[model samples]
Target: MTRKRVLCISYQFPPFAGTGVFRVLNFVEHLPDRGWDPVVLSVLPGHYERGTALDDGLCARVNGSARVHRTKCFQGIDAMLSLRGTFRGNATPASAGQGETAGTAPAGKGFWQGVKDAVTLAYRIPDKQVGWLPYALAEGVRICRHEKPELIYASGGPWTSFLIGLALKAHFHLPLVIDFRDPWMNNPYDELNVGFRRRVNRFLERWCLRRADAVIANTEPLRTLLADTAGSGNKCHTITNGYNETEYVGLKARASGTVPLVVTHVGNLYGKRTPDSFLQALTRLIDTGRLGVHEVAVRFIGHVDEARINNLIGSHPVSAMVTCVGVVPKNQALKMLFQSDIALLIQPDTRLQIPAKLFEYIRSQKPILAVCGEGATQELIEAHGLGVVADADDPEGMEGAILDVFRQARSAEGHVKKDYMAFEAGALTTQLAGVFDGVFQSSPQMKNG
Candidate 1:
């Protein structure tokens, strides 16, 4: 019964979908059925075909249970202008069962593929965690001397996969676990769009969370803002971002509630998670006609910043009841949040607390309106009674909680049971395998001790 290896360094996995690499690729694709053996160290598909998430059956269920090293995604030209603003603001990073040239990558080329894309920003391919610090410290000293791992999980988009698990925990002093999917220097937009290369990435996230043994955080208000900026708030914890019941029953068997009364909203919109005070209270109930007998359709998918959505349609007033589907494809944004009827989540009133798309907006229970700020994403949408909880920094209490969830969808008239589609992504990856067995059984008995 000896199995607990884990070496999961990530740079947005599963074909690199957007945001916090699918909770460390479903904890290295279900931490080898509770005994653990994950050895992932990602970033491949020639410049992350728009940030990974192409399931060839989730890459044969994570290369048939972990040991999936990729390395080789160097696009620097500001990561190719953030992948040409996520493929000209349509955010989807490939795989519609791959066709269209197996999705992305032949956008006109020549001159030896533009001199190997200008020497892939100086090629270093140490198993491709980009910015190859001595090829990620020589593949973190060959995966700490051939996966002698006990625990060394690290994640990030470009925060250099937490300096490749802080150089394999400073070369073998093991049990490390640093995983801050966001929040380095408690980001709330300060300092040149949080750059000076994130002040050398907050001095490598304070030397890997003061030399980690455990620092997890995905949001209990970013584990109390990274334990009050590593002054040690009980060494930071929280393991959130769930919803998987076999990828929400394969997204409710190829979704499509036909469309219309939609009112959706997926991810990536910055500086106060902008929805501009619930589109200025749905443009004052659609220019005072008070959306009576509802025919609403607000959508706004992802990365749509057409000048911050034409400044949220010239400062709202139902900006013609917006529908700017800019960045689709996370299976068409979960089949438009499984035929949405209202899942409006918006946050950033100082990173309110949790927002890994609020666990796929609580499994798309299809009634969330949350405007943010009252913490723990309004107590996990009032402990999953899931529906409305406004105030993206208050506007008449976020327009009286979106006109009381549009008066409970104009006095209900149908069937429902949407606890965000009753969660279960393998029981939320076995509650992140009980937070990696309460952080390697409260580490410090160490493999490097």
Candidate 2:
């Protein structure tokens, strides 16, 4: 089989830990096994989120799996601010929902944000990172010439990643498979203004989506959104974020074969899904002795809203039982999930959000307590019979779900692991590779094919 060369332009690559990295990570990590060569074009380590560690092992795998081109650049402002307090990775989708999350972009976010908003009348900036465009374009073109990949896969956060792919598609006529890890203009979370700029962003978003041979979205809802933005009858694919059982390697148990029902929430805790109710409910479980002594511990094992955490713990019941482990390494995270009898998947509402952590929760082989969005998440969890779900916004509802998982755990008919390998990392990558394969075959110019 001939190896297909792929140029992957990812705005925030590894060393930039967050949900956004998952897009290109699978493609780059699995390309070699699938007979594709990936040339990754990305910014320097610590470019946006400083000290956000990359998985060296994963990088080694990517290094062996494909070629990487690092176009190192940084903002002096970000660097200077580093001295005062670490600028969290919460800016772009890389860490969206993690920090002060979507905190009102200050009146003076920067020149481009203001100009784009004014010009388009968009309430928010138009895919900010407008500053990164020129550099990514120049570097992407250079990589395109050198590697001359059969197809370019640009997954975004800086949004410029897709722009780079579009540039290559226009200049080299290379087949481009643009991945929308997050939506371009009409993403559910996007705060859109009422007028001209919103229309302008809609135009650019449509142009990018329509031009792509195929597009990949993280959720079915997002796929629907992309399809609507791309117009009727355009093809959009949903290849979700997942856990790799094979990559899961080995996991450590958080509790030593004991009965205290442990509820684990991993990954970014954005504003969309508040954990206050979840924590409060679990505290009630302990208070009423509904949860056996030491039987209920709620571990929030990732970056979260620290200030809110303090306030919630102060007012809510289970202050002693709730522990916030701020952003540990992935291995540690996996271990937390492994030992967990219940995986807590929280979202703000049954509204327009589906946290990527839901898939990982299912794949963790633990019972899931799904909080929020009955959209796609409820569909999959129910189909798989994975776990119980609660509404985070409803304390009683969330508490009820927690106790249900606990009851199931102690019952003789303890929940057995379902076939979650379907959501494994490599399988999902293969799903994406199929997208690339289709585009490659559609392009007539590849001489060898």
Best by TM-score: 2
Candidate 1 wrongly placed segments (more than 4 Å): 13-20, 25-33, 37-134, 144-262, 268-303, 306-341, 344-362, 367-415, 418-449
lDDT tens per residue, model 1, 285-324: 6667756324677878887565766665585545556877
lDDT at 344 for candidate 2? 80
Cα distance off (Å), candidate 1, residue 246: 18
| For model 1, the run of ten residues with the poorest summed lDDT | 120-129
* lDDT tens per residue, model 2, 197-218: 5676667678888888888887
Which residue runs of candidate 2 sit more than 4 Å off their true CA positions? 49-58, 72-125, 188-197, 232-234, 252-257, 283-293, 305-310, 313-317, 350-353, 412-414, 446-449
C-alpha RMSD values across all candidates: 19.2, 7.9
What is the TM-score of each predicted model, taking all chains together? Answer: 0.33, 0.81
The true-versus-predicted C-alpha distance at residue 216 of model 1, in Å, is 25
